[model samples]
Target chain A: MSELISGSEILMQSLLKEGVDTIFGYPGGAITPVFDALYDFQDRFNYILTRHEQGATHAAQGYARVSGKPGICLVTSGPGATNAITGIGDAMMDSTPLIVIAGQVQAELLGTDAFQEIDLVGITQPISKWAYQIRRPEDITWAVARAFYIASTGRPGPVVLDFAKNAQIGKAEFYYKKCEFTRGYIPYPEISTKQIESAAQLINDAKKPLALVGQGVILGNAENELKSFLEKADIPAASTLLGLSAMPTNFRLNKGFLGMHGNVGPNMKTNECDVLIAIGMRFDDRVTGNLKTYAKQAKIIHLDIDPSELNKNVKVDAKVLGDAKVSLKLLTDAIQNAKHGEWIDSFKEHEEKEFEKVIKKEVFPENGPIKMGEVINLISEASNNEAILVTDVGQNQIMAARYFKYSKTRSIVTSGGLGTMGFGIPAAIGAKVAAPDRKVCLFVGDGGFQMTMQELGTILQEQIGVKIIILNNNYLGMVRQWQELFFRKRYSSSVMINPNFGAIADAYKIKNQEVKDRKDLKKAIDEMFSDDKPYMLIVETEKEGMVYPMTPAGDTVTHILLGDE
Target chain B: MENENMTLYTVSVFSENRVGLLNQISIIFTRRRLNIETLSVSPSALKGIHKFTITTFSDADTIEKVVKQIDKRVDIIKAFYNTDEDLVYQEIALYKIATDQLIKLGSIEEMIRTYNIRILEMNETCVVLEKTGHYEETQALFSELSQKVNVLQFIRSGRVAINKSKIERLSDMLANLNSRKPEGYVEDDEYAGY
Candidate 1:
């Protein structure tokens, strides 16, 4: 039986049909109909209101990343939709699944520039996976279903649906049917057995095989498959930044993170491997420094769901296009259990050298301003290495990526490809919403935190219990570091003169603490995470502290400087 | 990197008819800093679907990425890139010249025979000539006519292409989608409650 319902009701019904129980959004003029309908469905789903549209989007991203579901955000037209562009682009670059619904002016006023009207679909088309404007009330259910389907499908990214005001209030015969098939859109491509067999053969014969895992493994939920494949093949694995926490930190064959500021072992030993099996990770420029020489000596086998990423950057010997969970299991079944003792030992040797030359001094410095690494270590220990670590971009992010030890998949959420600052707090709110039972910790730099610190109001309103740790270096630390090393220490406009964060937190009526000494670090962290309410900790760190084991621009991965020259 | 001689690639996209899709597709080209040298949109063989033929000067790598991004659109059925050699393509040009000038030159018949042009219409003041060929061929004919007569107006339609392969890829894709169940749909029993 079909019931006649308003377009707003159709949207709410469609969302419920898709198994969505929560949405992060902000209400405004054009979206009144949706909000009115939401008022009736309040008992079915929870809507967490954020201060700004961007905050809602990031929070949705946080929820998506942690829950492995499409995060939903709703906002009104014009400024509200424009403000969300950054988050949409961030989700696109990071491959996060998000559905942003922006209300528009009446359909008649679409191009006439009516009050609170913008071409959101046109603006967001390039950045989003799919974008469309709903012109008819009859199409509401179908549009909502399509948005969810496109947003959460293969290589998930953000999708936008712009609903005209007339459609929202107009009546429609609503039969809530989830979108199953889009005419031209294929969610999953068929895997070729021949390609998998060739990749398996290469793995079986290679003496020194290294696995470069990316966030795709987590996105595909192939953690167990990846573990089994690594164990069976006896291959050493390394993670890209977003790929962190896919493998448990203490996994025997897991050789830490790999990139410009990554562990010395993975970056230095990338060229030494005979075969590089890239699983679910695109070779971004940051991950592969100087592509001309990146893993040049290795025979590469790339396994990914997206066909475009196969030879986009680094040329590969064999390509297996399919979901990671399926392809990895097939490769594991085709290969024999073997061990490369000496090859693994070589990576260990490099790790030890890095620890002796860089990690020891940077993480365990004794008599100076509290280092960023120490702060991350204290928080990691206080949370028992189990908290979901959300970080903003800059030195704070790189330091946290280096110091925090993750024991679970989907535990670390950061803006990876977009390198978006102001991402931590709102995303941490989303993570807390998605996984309320787990502890959520946000590590943000002072510069990045100030970009979206207004989200403190969001935390206060929602009572989200996220632990906020601000690494205050009194400057845009990452840019400052770059200037210091490469540009004769000109400093530029990186210096940020700021307000007292503790006072700001107090104004928000949330608990706050400050740590300038090493003695206060652990206790402050314990106190911050001790309460279920949101708390902010400001840690003063040395201004000139730089991320080491750096691969200068235009240089090979192997040519890395262990320390500041 | 700043080479002048970049190969031109023709990208064809098959999509369902929707407003603003052209704007969306054009934005991708704008973001990549690639200019669309020519573009044409018309109904495809499919009843409700449309085909967009776009030409841009870029390398194979960039064109491949553009096609992949275009394919990501929900309404887009499929997008493919082809080099000049892989497809047989043609463009039509319409030229309007002063009737008095053409008659005075007394070379309208000679020009029509030489360039394989057709007279679309004629009036007391002007005549319209249609030329169907490659872009360069059309341009060359227009130049010769202009040198001899007073050209009042000149317009060219974008390239329309047909792949050398016998089978239409879009037909195969649509058939494949038809053979399968719609995505994300649950059984009727499962949807009874919600």
Candidate 2:
């Protein structure tokens, strides 16, 4: 017997096939049919209703970013779909896997000036990795499958599917299947064997070769292979901002991050290394400093999944285009295992010396709330290396990078390229939903948390236990940090008026705490982790507290300035 | 200059309207800049779309780069550059000559025949003379005619030229992106099981 289904069923079926267990969304006129269809199959999936469409999109982004799975979200037509623009753009810039299904006015009303009708396909074309408008019921499954394929594969990004009202209602046979996209989409780059040979040779011959892993390693689930590769090659490794947690921070060869505010060992190693094998990193201008002098002593070997990245900026002595896991595994297998115990020991020696010289001196103002570093270190210690740390942009991100010794693969998820404010809480909510067994904590600043604080309602409604620790500096600390350093302390528009965050959490019916002193911070953190309810901790900090060892924008690795130096 | 030496010319062309107008005219210029030279609605071209024919005034390699940048702009229909010696070209203009100097010009009839100029419009106070030929020839006439008659209200409608040689346009980039099929191209089955 054959069964007939509506286009909405096809959309739902495609999400199920893609292993999308949760979706964050809002309901509206154009999307009523999707909601109705979702109502029937509610057991098959979970939909979290958000206060706004933007929250739904950000939440989806957060889930995708942390889980390395395709995040799914639904929204109504016109304004609801348009509201997801910023979040979708953020996901695009950061290369997060997201499948955004937006309802549209009926096929007949698509171009007409009908109520709630808009050209969603045209509007989302540039921002999304791919977008499709389904006018017929029969094409719904194919379009949605195509959306997932485009979104999850290659360089992951947001893909929007505009389901027309009539099409969602019209009947069609549902057949969920994987599809081959044979059009203006060539996602993977072909890595030449010669290129692989040269890259492997560089790894085999280097005296101090460091593997700078990025988010791509984690996204591809290649962390285990990378760890094995590092162990086999006996090469020390560092990470980029997005690359944190790809290798466990406590690993013997892990040298932490290697950019402007990266760890002392990694930053120093980048300056001294003879060969740097940058795997899955863009060598972003921020990471490379001045491109001309970036790694002048080294022969760079760049291995990335994207072709455009190869030789686009930093000249790579060898460019390999393949999956980081697959590529690293191959490179590991080809080379004979060798020992570089002395080189590894040298890294530890430098780390210890720098730790004594710079990190040992911690002079706080001797007042109010704890320093951001103290909050981060205390929380990192309390969480016991199992918590997923999601940070909003600014000083909070920098402090988290400095203090958190991320020991799990893909444990830290932040909006790296987009650096969107308020990305922390919703992302934390999504991350908690993705991995409920693992404790997810949000390290957000007072300025960044306010952007999407409304998602606290969703957290409450879902009763998902997430610890949101807000560093109440009363300013957009990163901008204020920059303004203080480079802009000569003009302090414009960075300051925030007193916000009753504890009261706001109470209003949402979530448990709230205020940590007023350094000792109180540790107490608040302990209580937050032990609590079964959604909790927010307001840690009051110095108004202009800056994260130190800051390399001014576009400065080299050696051009770092420690605070009060 | 050596026989092999060359430079590219970035030309701005303005012309009259017709269908397949650009393809017909630009077929003459080889190694053309790929975008029209900022087409604007000229008071000429009978108040039609002002088309630009942008090309580099250097060697073929320089013109290739110039063409690539210009071809990307959506507004431009066509772009190409050609050497002055290679193409049949023409520039046309209308000059309203003062009637008082008509006698000093010895007769509009004699001058029109001598310079291959056409008398498009005539009035009692002024005579409008039209010329169509190579851009240099038209300029020469415009200069020589001004000597005899006070060239009142002169308008150079601009040049429309093309290369006499045949050349194929550059290949499309979108086509290149579509034709690639690396390993693991097909993740799904050729056909789903029944």
Candidate 3:
């Protein structure tokens, strides 16, 4: 037997062995044992005390997305675990690798309905990759190792480890072994040569091929391989919302974003392309628009690590089921070189039409109230596309995604699949922690910012150097826009009577500015980014602003509404 | 993943017996709106492996998806689905009745001969009868007994199934893995793979 150690100490050792130096969490009654042990282990760990357990999870997700390492978050039982459910669901949808440890009531008191008790494993089971309860101290080492392995492998996802209080205090022999190959859980499926050859054959023969990329390219670390594949074949590619920054904004073959509010060209070309190659993306309904109409003319090829995702949304003619990092190179090698100039030019025509009609007005407005896109576009220009663009959900997120440019991979951090508001502030802090060298600029709506405004305390406490740009339209703009379009402009509970954000920032002892005029906008952004410390730039954006190039609900991907007409 | 093309499919899930593993597997079936017709859990031939035998009605598409999801669980070894034609199955049931009520019916030996049941235990107050057969066959005896005399206690085991093939799928998979294993390859721990 190895030397006996307390359950809490086993957790610390297990975490340390997994290369976790930074921890994001909230401590509470059931989890006090772990926190008490962490006090002695402070010299080796950097513990971030998030105001809410929910914030911790989103922060962890942000960190994971940026660093390519599984984020570790700890929360107490009961309400603490329940609060973090949204983030867990968000991580599941976006494929962010996170290890969420929720403290549970004592093992003996598990079914007694003890104080602060929660059935954490039961609640988290559906959303998480795995939910295991550690009722005894001895299970810590194995569970932690397994959690890390299961979380960070294949299509990465969140895993919850429910820790009972008794287990935290109990003593047991400690030992840890890194998991290499799990018996049934195959993270990396064996790549098939037949599939690769077939994929190559289809792509080589296609006259009009469009590559619809997703975040899998970034997660698989196949950005270079993807670029090489696209360049070799000279195929125009567009990215899903999460798939942004997999290829830089200005790459020649990189068309634009895809989805409902995405760039017009990519949305239209999706229907036109005779052959659609989807890499590392599930055909999310938002991206596909309508099942019956989406890519009906195209022979679809899907490449992903998860077999379940292959026919989940769209049927694939050729399925390359493996890590795209490995498969893309093989696919590139097998395919014969070709060009689709005329096919590519068709996409360009639609894009040019979009630029003339919508992009110009959104990004270069000279008069009237300040536009969200204008500020985003200018910030991209100001940062020289070097800063990471993080956004909270709703109008701000779409505008930021549309206008903000990128120069690097893992640069776009936003809650895509589970569009959780208030994801901005905490996620930005996590992003800053993951990439201390890079500038993390966050664009959040006033409605979303206040949702997790308590995280502002966390920023001040840690002095995280992140630039926050709150697009204060004074309304929940996304819903308001929806109501305006579909609900006959009856804005029911969409508008907000808010507080002084500048005052809130001052109370937190952080530098802040409110930009109401266009001239002040540039200066305010400059001031926000001038210093390394936390800064919030509150921009008074147009309350009536709408995100356009809309594919009306159940409409075809190609038929987008450019304006009210 | 549920669809209208419903058919009887037996989904066998092999896993390490773990806390809440049964609940996790059941939840998947519930989410797909597939009702479990019969279920059983028992240790497998292989050490440290537990097998869950579940019978449910679902199309091939839904079952395939559900099996894939079940296999994705951390401790699960593998999951497979097969139609009734692919496997041989059986179930065991027990019936306990008052001796006085049973004696009132004439030709007790004739009843035993026709129903294919054996007496497990006989006491002053009650007699226990055991029957092993498919679900319908067991149910037929249950109907006859309930009409003749009230059953003091009745219990039925879930369906236990084995593929009609000569070799088990798990054994085949292990053998294939062994043959492909590098020369002189040794496991770090005997139970680690499980």
lDDT against the true structure, each candidate? 0.89, 0.75, 0.90
**Compared with the true structure, what per-residue lDDT tens digits does model 2 show for residues A1-565?**
3688888877788778878789899999999998998998889898899888888888888788777788888999989999888788888877788888888999878678789887776676556766677778877776777777778887788888888899899988887766655333455556577888998888788888878888789877889988898899888998888888888878888887777777667776777888898888888876767776778898899888866566666777987888887888878877768788887788777677556554554323345446887787778889897788888888888788767878687688788877788788888888888888888888999988889888989988999888888989888888888888888999899878967998899899989899877766667788898865688888887777767666777877777676757
DockQ, candidate 2, vs. native dimer:
0.08
Q: Candidate 1 — which residues are off by over 4 angstroms?
A: B1-5, B180-194
DockQ of predicted model 1: 0.53
lDDT of the structure predicted as candidate 1: 0.89
DockQ winner between candidates 1 and 2: 1
> Taking the tens digit of each residue's C-alpha lDDT, what string does model 3 give over A1-565?
6689999999999999999988999999999999999999999988999999999999999899999999999999999999999999999999999999989999899888899887888888888898888888877887888899899989999999999999999999887777665566778888999999999999999998999999999999999999999999999999999999999999999998999988888888888888899999999988998999889888899999998888877878999999999999999999988988888888767888888888889889879999998999988888889999899999999999999998899999999999999999999999999998889999999999999999998999999998999999999999999999999999999989999999999999989999899988888777777878899888999989999888877788887888748
Which residues of candidate 3, in runs, are more than 4 Å off? A1-3, B1-4, B96-98, B108-111, B121-127, B144-154, B175-194
DockQ of each: 0.53, 0.08, 0.42
Q: Over 4 Å off in model 2, which ranges? A: A1-4, A111-113, A181-184, A348-350, A361-369, B1-194
Cand. 1 TM to true fold: 0.96
In model 3, how large is the Cα lDDT of residue A194?
99
| Model 2 interface root-mean-square deviation | 11.3
Best by TM-score: 1
